[model samples]
Target: MKQGFVKVAAATPDIRVADVWHNCEEIRKLLSEAEKEGAKVIVFPELCLTGYTCQDLFTQDILLKEARRALERIAQQTKNSGSLVFVGMPLAVDGELYNVAAALNDGRILGFTTKTFLTNYGEFYEMRQFRQGPEKARVISYEGQEIWFGPQLLYQAEEMNELIVSAEICEDVWSPVPPSIQAAREGAVILVNCSASDETVGKDSYRQELIKGQSARLMAGYVYANAGDGESTTDLVFGGHNIIAENGTILKEARRFTNEMIISEIDISRMLGERRKNTTFQTAKERNLPRISFTVNLEETRLTRRFGANPFVPQNMEERAKRCEEILMIQAMGLKKRLLHTNSKTAVVGISGGLDSTLALLVTAKAFDMAGKKRKDIIAVTMPCFGTTDRTYHNACLMSEKLGATLREVPIADAVRTHFRDIGHDEDVHDVTYENAQARERTQVLMDIANQEMGMVIGTGDMSELALGWATYNGDHMSMYGVNASVPKTLVIHLVKYYADTCEDAELRAVLLDVLDTPVSPELLPPKDGEIAQKTEDLVGPYELHDFYLYYVLRFGFEPGKIYRLAKIAFEEQYDDETILKWLRTFYRRFFTQQFKRSCLPDGPKIGTVALSPRGDWRMPSDACAAVWMKDLENLTFNKTGGYSL
Candidate 1:
């Protein structure tokens, strides 16, 4: 598979108790479908050959003999299939009965991975029939074949080096220390479970959490195939819940009471990268276990997995609200710690009525409240220059007053004009110097005011701005502590709206709602027809697009081409191919050129997984060349009609 993406499936096929022939046919049908879907790895539920309801029937020698024959036939059925398949069955070795998952690929059995932990308590009577499987590596003869049988067996793909797989039973993952952990430590990037878990009042949710936590802890892709409908319901009901997860994110899940297959593409490279970054995730030096290597035809896997356009922000409303609250609390707590440690009596913030500054002011008020200080101690400064509008200026003053903070307005028109005259710059000319002059003047005012009032200046620049280096050096970019530093522009909108809905003060809510409606702008240039003309998105690309670019680039280390492909899929309906490419190029150019400003970023709390804080999460050279990235973009071919050739 190209880009280390392997298509995998978890299937729950219909089963009948002690009916090996019928079950084998069902398995064959599902296997055929999966192979047709281009699945390289497919897993079936536990004890599917002889249904889990076959309780005491598991002790019968006739069923065992038939199951062995059925397994051989199943292996033969997959001789022409391309996938590496795992099937559950009962096996007896030296008079000891064991539950195992047989790994089959091409015409023969690769190995047998026994269930390490047997569920015997409560509703399960697995221990009544089968004993705990052998923990050490061992070989056993079954069906006239010597299969490597043990709990520490790992199956590796011949062509792809990262596709190392291991397996355990249903209850093994519930153990205090799962075998998956040791298997991962032995370099298994994918874990499979042949599970027959029954459903209860809240067990489904708990089971989902268990699988997600285990996958995250092991840093491996987990495929859980559970016994579903048709399993005997003597004491428990099987829901047939199958899941495919990777690194804590559930990629695909099946509905309960359904005999269906859940398929998704696994990015093995991303998991390996995560493991390599986390030094504390230690591995064993020498596992001293046997590895069974098999070959699957090397072919490109067509991905059907969906990548969210906005990875930093949750799409669900309730989840987004919860995340916003958590991030806000973290920001406030960070500021509170600094205030307490410094023994400062006040916090100085520049109120621009923009999303980032508004959030900074909100966090400052929260920090003051947390420190048991009056909100009046938070000094909100508004500096109006040539580009000042009645709407933003009024909103800035109103927000400060409604929040019970002390508001101070310093008009910088005369100060800037005097400075412009001193520098011999034309008053009518609007250039970088004209705009940066206003930004530096505002920062100078805030810094001096903070010194005068015995407080610290809170920065309002967000992660998106920092990524594109859209801040004036030593201007709005510098602060005593940047509460919104790690937060991105797309998430900032929701955070502000979340505060507006939750903050009960009616006047404060009204001001916040208006601020959310205002267009994002620096307001450095004069107004056109008394309306703001200096829009940030028009000069740069959209913040939504830039934030998307920032996440894949910093979080997963994806190359330009891969990110472009994913972005095209995620934003297909919202944006066109040409528009995406145009902004994408802008994003790369600005992101590379703006690293100098980020190299010396101010102290800010890291609020999420992706951050541009120079002190944490990111460390890039300021002068690094963008030639390699640009070359990749240049190599992207365009059609005669101007669209991407792809």
Candidate 2:
């Protein structure tokens, strides 16, 4: 598998009970279908060679003989398929019957992984006909060929070292210590379960959750294939419920009562990166598990997995609203603790009627409420300079009055001009110095007012600005406490809207709604015809794209090429390839060059997994080079017609 992505499938073939030849034919057909779809690893239901419903007939010599022949035929059929297949059957080893999942590839039986935990309770009587497999692996003669037979067989791909696979039967996973646990600790990235779980009322949900939880716990990909229709429904009905999951998220799930094959590409590199980050996931001290290697042609897998355009914000409205509420409470609580510890009597917030400032003011009010302080003691200041717009100024004053916070207006145009004259800079030259001077003057006003009022100046810059180093150093960047430090720009809009929708005061809600509708800008440059002239997105690209790049880069540590591929898929409908690549390059350059600002960031709470807290989740050196990452992007060629090639 190339790029550590291998397409895998979980197939539930329809088969008759005790009909070995028919079951083999169905398995071969499904296997061929999966092969055509470019699946490198395929798994089938347990005991499919002879259906799990074959209760007493399992002891018959004719059925066992036919099953052996069927296994050979399946193995022969996979000679040119180039897919590693796992099928189930009852095998006789050393005069004892064992329910086993046989691993076949390239006309050979690579290994046989037997069921470690037999299901003897409830409707299952597997212990009655089969013995539990041995804990240690051993070579056994099967049909004149020596095959590794045990419960701890690992199927590793020679092409990609991270594409290590392991198998376990149905009941084994249900047990407390699943064989997959050891397999994962021993370096298995993908775990396949050959399950024959019969259908019952409400059992499917539990089964699905169990598979998801196991994948999450082991930090590996899981493929589950269950038996389906065509089995003799003498006492129970098996509904083919196939599922493919990676690291707790289910990529594909087949509907019940319909024999379906579910296919999805597993991201082995992501799982390995997660493992590398998690300190608790320790590797086994004794690496004694038998490793069975298989060869497959390496190629980039066609991704069918869905990557959400907005990773920080949830897609579902209900879930998004819930998340927004929880995040607000978390931000408020963090600020509340800081205020209580500092014993401050007031909290000062610079209100610009912009998204970040609006959110900061709301959080400050919430913190005051949580700390049992008066809202009047919360100072809301609006600093108007040359770039101040009438609409934003009006909204700022109205919102402060409606929230019952003491509002103050500080016009800094005169102070900035005096400073400009002292520095011998032209007053008409609107450049970086002109913009940063206004920002620093506003910060000075806020800080001095906080000191005069016995309060703390709450920072308004969000995580997105911090990532791109968009905030002026020691200007809007410096504050006593940053409430929205970990929040991205994409999520800030949603959080403010959530509050507006839930607030009881109609006037306050109206102002918040207006603020959400206003364009994102820093208002550093002079206005054009009294309208805002400096748009942040127009210069730094869309925050949505930058946030997407930030998430993949920081959360998973994915390479630039891989992140670009995922971005193209996620934003295909909204942005062209050239636009995405352009912004992506900008994001990388800014993120690398701006680390010095983040190196000495103020204290803030981490709201999500992707945070830039220097002392916390991210600890990158300020002087790290971006040449290697930039070179990767430069190698990609993009055409004018929204197409790209690497």
Candidate 3:
């Protein structure tokens, strides 16, 4: 597998009722196709060895025996193919027939996972011919081969240690408690389901939701292979809705009614890390019936799934709008609670014509409105320093008036010059002090106004600034409440665009679109031809890359090398290899060093999986060293020959 990715497939092969030999040929063809696509693990639909719709024909002795022989032949055919494969059929154990997903690896039956729940409702009549399988496992001799079989089996990969595969049947997943849930809890990073769900109206949507929700609930990779076309249409039709999902998101899905294979490369390490962090998942594993044994040497598989450049924002417009609205509500509700509890009469925010400040101001307006207070009670302060441009100053004033908030401008050029003189800082040489002075002055003005007006100084810094520790300590970092504290810099742009899209007033929308277009800057240096002179990305690297690193690091707990690998794929069109590497190095250094800033972070609401709130999402010690993480990242640059394959 490439890095920790294990390419897996959920396939539905053409089948004929009660024709085990013909079915085996179809299985071989599909399996070979999956192996060619670098799928390390492959799954066929339930009763694929003999079509699920075989019905009473399932009682035929010759058909059952041929199904067993077909299983053996398929295992032998895939011995050299290197992938671990799952095929469903009937297995007789202790003189009782049980529906089973037979696990095969290297020409042998590694084990068999029996269906935990049998459906007798509506269309299923498996109970008439097959007994419900054992919940616990035991070695059983079948056709002179002893194999472990049960619902508790866990297929561990020796080659890819992080990769684990486990299986359950169709009805098992529909139960209140699915066996895959416990299987996932038991360290199986991927849960495969061999299903024979018949087609019905709106069934695909429900199936899609089930697969996605199961992945989310288990926090693991899920591959669902349902019965396909060509199954005996005696009373039901199965439109193969094969799916592959990771962590609740569908990565790939095959169109129903077509004989298709769904393939996806899942990050086993990420799923493993997620399971590690969730105490409940680990605890569930401990108490659930002991895990049964099935081991496979994971064949080396290449990744085919493409990661997104912007992980924070959705690509779909309708979904993006919904997400934007949800995020805005989260920010507003968080501020509203703080305001209500503190009994603050007003909220004071510095309006900078910049995106971060604009979003914070927008959220503040909503919070006040929800609290049944007048928008005028919001003290919107504009503090211009030495480098302030007329454009931003006027825009800030205009925004305050249009939003119906109290507009107050406090220019701090002379006061900051006096402070610089006191501190022996050269006014001509504008450096850290020069930049931080403006931010602190702006914060100071808002704080004093908030105090005087009996209001809260709502923080304007978003999650991105907090992640890279770009904001000055005790400057923009301190506030009564942070509205956009959990929002990433990448998402901030989309939120502005979302507001622009929804604005009723063309003039206000025009201003918002311009604000969205504006390069993120503090406007703390003299304007160059009436434009921003101090762009943030030029100094600290792109927030896109930093936010990418932060999400994988904090949310998935991915190693530096893994994050670097995925980033290259996500931003291949935008950033060259060396440029991405350089920025990745910078991200690791800043993120680890900035733990001190995050360790004492002010109160904020966590809107996403990635958050740096000291007391909540993040609890790392400020003094923790970055040496190990840096060294790993540096190693990637040295061995830069990887990812040469297009």
Give the per-residue lDDT digits (tens) of candidate 3, residues 1-646.
6557878899999998888999999999999898888787899999999989887777788888999989999989777666889999988777788899998887778888999899898987888989998868877887787778889588776555666788999989899999887777667788999999999999999999999999988888899999989898878989999999998999999999998998888877777777778876663526444343334445455556888888888989899999999998888889989999998988999888999999988888888888788999998888887667777777788777877899887888888888898899998887888888877877888888888888889988988888778888888888888888889999989888888788787777877877887788888788888778889999889889988888888888888777887888899889877777788788877877887877777788889888888788888877778899888766763445644221
Q: Candidate 2's error at 251, in angstroms? A: 0.5
Q: Over the stretch 487-591, how does candidate 2's per-residue lDDT look in tens digits?
A: 999999999999999999998999999998888999988889989899999999999999999999999999888888999999989998889989999999999
lDDT to native, each model: 0.90, 0.92, 0.84
On lDDT, the candidate that comes out on top is 2
TM-score of 2: 0.99
Pairs that collide in candidate 1 are: 228-240
Candidate closest to the true structure, highest TM-score:
2
TM-score of each: 0.96, 0.99, 0.95
Two-way lDDT contest, 1 vs 2, winner: 2
Clashes of each: 1, 0, 1
The residue ranges of model 3 lying beyond 4 angstroms of the native Cα positions read 284-300, 637-646
User: Runs in model 2 with CA error above 4 Å?
Assistant: 639-642
Cα displacement (angstroms), candidate 1, residue 620, comes to: 1.3
